[model samples]
Target: MFKKLSIGRDGADAQARGAGAEQRALDYLRRQGLRLVARNYRVARGPSARGGEVDLILWARDGTLVFVEVRARERDAHGGAAASVTRAKQRKVIFAATCFLRALAEIPPCRFDVVAIDGDRVEWLQGAFDVPAEH
Candidate 1:
């Protein structure tokens, strides 16, 4: 689940903040033993596509493909970082994952993960949400 962060409407700033958070999450995950495969993976399925971007894609030590959604909040005024991952966001990640796998030789086991950062603290949620269907 996402923490429903309160982000500004300013797209560029939001992206900068998102990139920073993703870097933090990536570093932390690397320390935890996940191998970085892709960062900021995006694919467009066109006009009616549910496609979007995936913050970080990691390969678990045991071969699981990890799709991570990175969230961060400067303050907990809204609901913290985990509160931001809405169903729509999850769907977008899923769609992007599908596009990524289409180029793979074989699809492996995978899970959706959330890395929530509040203030200076970071919390990693494994299997935060089930991998959504491509359709």
Candidate 2:
């Protein structure tokens, strides 16, 4: 999966690039038969605060709920995008997912996926990472 790592210049421009990458990731997953559940899913940790942002959420072919993180970098400069998902970031995502699950009647099987794009190359890591229990 070769992706040219197309990202915007900086600031809001960079955010737009991130959004674009997310859309591309969503489209790619749709081609693979994943049904979209949500995009840019966010959960707040407080009454007036911000929390983690899940780039994309989808139902997998086997019906497993998927929480996706789309990372687009200019290059694999610092371990690329997949490697950028640190423990702290994982905690945030897990936190958001927990919030999402609370609204469900019955929670389905879930897994975390990452779509790492670096310099025109795309790597889709299924069940890429896990949620730390301590989080």
Candidate 3:
């Protein structure tokens, strides 16, 4: 993966870079034949509680509902961009997916995906995570 881009100071710059990464990921997925269903789909459980969000919700050619999380890093270090998707992040994405599914009459085969952008290079990982099994 490429590793030369420098994100500017402040939260806004990081947000802009994140949005750019998402756009790049969306374009790549579109080229791969995935239709966009939603972008930045979000939900909140309560007024005081943290919410969930899915970066991109897409429909694969085979009819799978794909929930994608787009991540970016200036350099691949300490496990890189893909490894940045931690368990807490996965839970938020999963929670958002559940909320999204509730609106559908029939649940389709679903998957969690990651679009990790390391500088200028991008990688798409299918089934990047799953709903954690209960104890």
The candidate maximizing lDDT is: 3
Residue-wise C-alpha lDDT for candidate 3, range 1-135, written one tens digit per residue: 998876667788778988999999999999999999999999977663768999999999999999999999999997889999999899889888988999999999999999999988899999998898860
Extract clashing residue pairs from model 3: none
lDDT of each: 0.90, 0.87, 0.93
Ranking by TM-score: 3, 2, 1
Report the candidate with higher lDDT, 1 versus 3: 3
Best candidate (score: TM-score): 3
- How would you encode candidate 2's per-residue C-alpha lDDT over 5-115 as one tens digit per residue? 856565988889898889888888999999998988898667636488788989999989999989889889989988998877887788788889899999999999999
Compared with the true structure, model 3 gives a TM-score of 0.89
Of the two candidates 2 and 3, the one with more favorable TM-score, higher being better, is 3
The list of candidate 1 runs beyond 4 A from truth reads 1-10, 132-134
What would the per-residue lDDT of candidate 1 be over residues 80-127, giving only the tens digit for each residue?
999889988988888888889999999999889999999899999999
Error of model 1, residue 63, in angstroms:
0.7
